[model samples]
Target: MLAGQRQSAILEMIAGSGSVRVATLVEEFGVSDMTVRRDLETLARRGLIAKVHGGATLVDGGSTEEPGFVTKSGRQAAEKEAIARHAATMVAPGSAIALSAGTTTWTLARHLVGVPGLTVVTNSIPVSDVFHQFGRPDQTVVVVGGVRTPSNALVGPVAVAALQTLNVDMLVLGVHGMSPRVGFTTPNLLEAETDLALVRAARRLVVVADHTKWGLIGISTIARLEDAGTLIVDSGLSREAREELSEHIDNLVVVEPSASGN
Candidate 1:
């Protein structure tokens, strides 16, 4: 196919999903990876798409746009680790906690492995796997059931139902985005519902997000600004942002990336 035709097709794919992976395009067009990258470069130059870490997204990838887990996981690795490290200190050993699915919360799960005799409930397959791979015998992990999304979060009725019966000491939640108006939000409607159920199941809510998540909005709102008991973010957050978030959230913890010892 012609270069223009291939670029057009790529745009169509991105339009359908709000984002597209280069590997998927390479396979679809039977082209070299380098060739696909050049095409993406051209399209990005045209201001039709924004180049992301692993792929491209609509330049205006709005409130409903959500990238896949792998695509988002590597975007802010150090900052997420720092945020996760601070969040781990908030959970006591032998307490029950729910980890909502997202890259940041998954990072937090790994940090909690050494905390003994804890009960973990999670809708994230990766989060559960981290414990299964390294958790002590005293640690119990309960995997919630539901349809999984590109973010690797189990959502829908099954996941919501599972959260209803459980009461956790704290919920270390992850969100797609948050805004002064929209609060904490997720792109998938079902995930929003599942996260809400999680909010209700926990005695306290702690949100872990890097600076990049602020000022953004998603399709569904999981909670309001004051809902979180504590909010942990990386040092990349601006002073203005910290002051603003501090006013709404009770305890806003910001940690430098180097302190995480990653």
Candidate 2:
């Protein structure tokens, strides 16, 4: 298998358990000890794993720590729903759109199911599943090809290749974190690469993120702050943050969770 695919498999194993020994990886992949160590070293550099004396362990509570979809789906329920609700209104009927992998984007997919004659491209398994269960007959859903992350996002070189062949009217993205310096970021390096491809495949970009995403930094950046054509955030964001974001994003929208009705 290719290096990227091998690395993705290694991350999956680490995610399933907690750590992987160099000897175990060598045996599992039929590769040399040096190759396995190189994989671990690459992952460690990205902050995705912690290197021990003879093995690698998962990273938690830092820039590279990525929570599973189930663990994150329940967080900031109201805020995410509010952002999704408002973001749904930005879509026009029959428009081709790309939805990045995230809980908020899955929620937005639910909202888009009824829109007539629309086409949706996504790398998120859960987001595509939403449409599979509820999409109208006139709608089309394209599932990008790649390795699955803990968040159920399909990302890697395969996903990037798929995205390069398609163009969409808009890209509705959800990020792990955002800041002035690093802009939009993700904990997974492969995910970041795939997201950047999605950004390039679209004409307009709309970012949907809750207030808590502010100030946190991830291992890799997907885009700069000014890259987003529109950014929809919840009112829980501080007044100072709103001002700071508005300076970069021309269309910065803040919705009150209570007032934003589904």
Candidate achieving the largest TM-score? 1
| Candidate 2 per-residue C-alpha lDDT over 159-253 given as tens digits, one digit per residue, 9 for 90 to 100 | 99999999999999999989898999999999999999999999999999987677768999999999999999987676778898999999999
| Error of model 2, residue 57, in angstroms | 24
Positional deviation of residue 192's Cα in model 1 after best superposition, in angstroms: 0.2
Q: Which prediction has the highest lDDT against the true structure?
A: 2
Per-model CA lDDT versus the true structure = 0.86, 0.89
Per-residue lDDT tens digits for candidate 1, residues 201-233, read 999999888766776678999999799999888
What are the TM-scores, per candidate, against the unseen true structure?
A: 0.78, 0.76
In model 2, the runs with Cα more than 4 Å from the true position are 1-60, 259-262
Error of 1 at 116 (Å): 0.9
